[model samples]
Structures are given as C-alpha cells and as structure tokens.
Target: MATAKTEKLSASLEDYLEAIYNLSVDGSVARSKNIAQALEVSRASVTGALRILAEKQLVNYKPYGYITLTKQGCIEAQRVVRKHNIIEKFFVDVLGVEHTVAQKAACEAEHAFGPQIVEKLLCFIEFVNSYNKNGYDLHDEFRSFFRKHGSIAAGDSN
Candidate 1:
C-alpha cells in the first residue's frame, strides 16, 4: 500500500525538490543553474520539472526568475534529503562502498525506503556509528549475524 506522501512523490520530483532545498539554504531563491549542476541534469530538464512543481503548488516558478519552494515543498524536500543522507551513510559506512559509489547508490535507495523504514535505518546507523570504526566490515558482520539468528518462518512463502 502506498502512503499518502509516497503516492505524491516521484524520484525525479524529489531530486529537484531536494536540490532546491539545498540551494535555498544559503539564500532565499534557488537558481536553475545551481539545481541543474547539483543534480547533473540538463537545464532544459530542470525547467520541465520546475513547471510541474509550480503546477502542483510546490514551488513558485517565474520564467528566468529564481525558484523558491512553497511550504509544502520544503517539508517534502527535508524528508528526501534526510533519506538521501541516511542511505549514503549506510552504503559508505556499513556496506564498505566507495564514497562516490555510495552516493549514487543512495540516490536509488532513498526512493525504495518509506518513512518508517527510513527512520529504522537512521537509528541503525546511529547505533553503528557509536562504537565502530570498521567501516565496510560492519555491514558484513551485520549480514552474518542476521543469517545466523533471523530465519524465515516455516509457513513463509518464497
């Protein structure tokens, strides 16, 4: 079942929203160039997405003018950013992936996790960060532990 927020979000939309949110942090308005560069997307693509966001009332987009998120946009962007950061940390620190690889993986992962799972992952990372310096090995250890202790129930289907 799709949650209300999940239903309203798309990976592309979230990326633009998050980009605007980041750009808006140091200033009141977000430039299209900044968003395009941050997302590594074409300016034309950014323009299209901005149009869509504006139609949804998530942002205020005026031709050739700076973009700014509406209140609802900011809330959604914060959630996306949080998911992206948490996923990146998990991939880099727990999975032992290279930083850049982890970042790309995070871009894909953020969409897969809903709010509930994202929060659980955040807590897991916090716990791991508290005592471990093993970086990548920690993820292997976790998998091994889960394999040893967490078994599928007899009635569970493949």
Candidate 2:
C-alpha cells in the first residue's frame, strides 16, 4: 500500500511529516515556528523540508505561512503514525519495555519497516490482546520465563 509520497519520503522528511500531522491533529494550522519547536529543528530546516513536501504534493506550503497536508499527505502521515503506534505497543505490551523507551524505540523503527510489516504487526498485537482477554496472560508468562532464564545479573527485575 505504499504511495509515491511514502516511497520517496526520506527518514528526515517522514519525521517532519509526522511532526506536522501531530501538531495539526486538532485541525489547527501548523506554523513553521511551531513545527521547528516540535521537531527541535531550525526554522530554515523546517522550511526546506516543507518545500520538498510541497513539491511532492504532500503539503500545502506557502512562504512564511502555516502548513497543511493534502488528502494524500494526511493518508501517508496516518500510515506513518499507525506504524509508530504499533511498534510502540509491541515494545510495551509484548517486550515489557518502559513506556518512554518504547516510544523512542518505536520512533526509530517507524521509518524502517514497510506497510506490510506494519499491517502484520497490527494483527499480531490484536491477536495477543485477544489471547490475553481469553486468559492466556502471555505478558506475565513471558516475565516469569525471562526472570527464570534471563542472562542479566542477579537481583535485576527489569
């Protein structure tokens, strides 16, 4: 399900798109200064990225003005966001990672995997959730097994 926009989006561009999408989640205009703050990048950098995105028809960018995604842009942004969320959930729920750690790791991973992997991951997460609801308690079982066989030094509960 990869689109032209998605296929050509570099990791840095994807980050900017994700930031803009998150900033404008409530239908507000995403200003360049705001985008700079959100991404911790310079306003010049944001502008450059916005230019590329605009050329790709992913964003409607005007000089020194607020930014907004086109319909195709929004769809691509949502796909990226969904991948990030799925990876984060897998880290937290299945791997027992800390919330912050999971979020950071997912941020890195979101750009690596493609739509097919992300869709499969979503299904795996749903299956695990349903399995847990059916009293499988897979998380606890993993924790128990890890505690018994984990290679970390003694007295480490993580």
Candidate 3:
C-alpha cells in the first residue's frame, strides 16, 4: 500500500497529474485545456484541480499560462501511472476483458488496489503470456464451461 500522503490524492488529481506528466514528456510544458481534454473534464474543473495540486506542492500553475509537475510530483505521478497500466494489463490478459473497457476500469481500480496486488497481477500476466506463442486465449469457451461446471470450471486458468 502507498503511504497515507499518497492516499490523500483523489482520482481526479491523479488523472490531471498524469496528463501533464505525459504531455510534458515530449514538450516543455502542458496547457490546462489539453489536460482537461485528455481527462474529459471542463477547463474550469482543470483550473480548480490545478489549484489543489499547487497547494499540495505537486504542480506549478499559472493562470492563462502553463503547468509543470514538481520533481516529487513527477515521481509520484509516474508511480501512479504505472499502477494504472499494470491494472489495465491485468484486466485484459488475466480477465480477458477488452482493451478500452480495461483502460477505464483500471483507472478506477488503480487507487484502491495496492501496489502489492498490482505486482502479483504483473506476475500473473507474465505467467499467462508464457503460453501466448502456443496460440491460446484463457477465455476461449469460458462462458459455456462456467455455465456447465459452475464458476470454478475446469481449465479456468489455462
């Protein structure tokens, strides 16, 4: 689990931080409207969120200007973003969920699921991928088998 200070982050704040970090990766700064568009929030909401992040020492925000993450904020955002990606991979590879749905669901789950669980999920993903070259999907015929044998169906993992 992350420390209590990290838990202080709301999902929205994390999302904004991630957006800026990603944009700033290839550029010098991030515009607020771009962050808003990426997160599907309005410009006003982006401003308000930036205000909160500035108070938390996560960002440097200037009205009608640009935003940039502090060094500590960049590290934190990278960790959070990694957790989100890990969860997305878990949903897609382990649960056989679709990519787009997994992205959204992972966004919601990353905050609640601790890094230890995410690490376990990463290992599970690698274990599943070990059989990839053999051309298999874990979920093929999954529904029928589950219906016939109950949820704990045979061959559920493979």
- Summarize candidate 3's per-residue lDDT along 1-158 as a digit string, tens digits: 43224446877788888888888888667888788888898989989998888877788777776688887789889988899988898887666666887888888888898778888988877876664546765555444564676665436332
lDDT score, candidate 2, position 104: 84
lDDT of 3: 0.79
Error of 1 at 66 (Å): 1.8
**lDDT of model 1 at position 94:** 69
What TM-score should be assigned to candidate 1? Answer: 0.74
Off by over 4 Å in 3: 1-7, 131-158
Best by lDDT: 2
36 in model 1: Cα distance from truth in Å? 1.8
Residue 14, candidate 1: Cα error in Å is 0.8
**TM-score (C-alpha, index-matched) for candidate 2:** 0.86
lDDT of 1: 0.82
Cand. 2 Cα-lDDT: 0.85
What are the RMSDs of all candidates, in order?
8.5, 4.0, 6.5
Q: For each of the candidates, give the backbone clash count.
A: 0, 0, 0
**Residue-wise C-alpha lDDT for candidate 2, range 31-71, written one tens digit per residue:** 89888998898989998999999988899988966689989
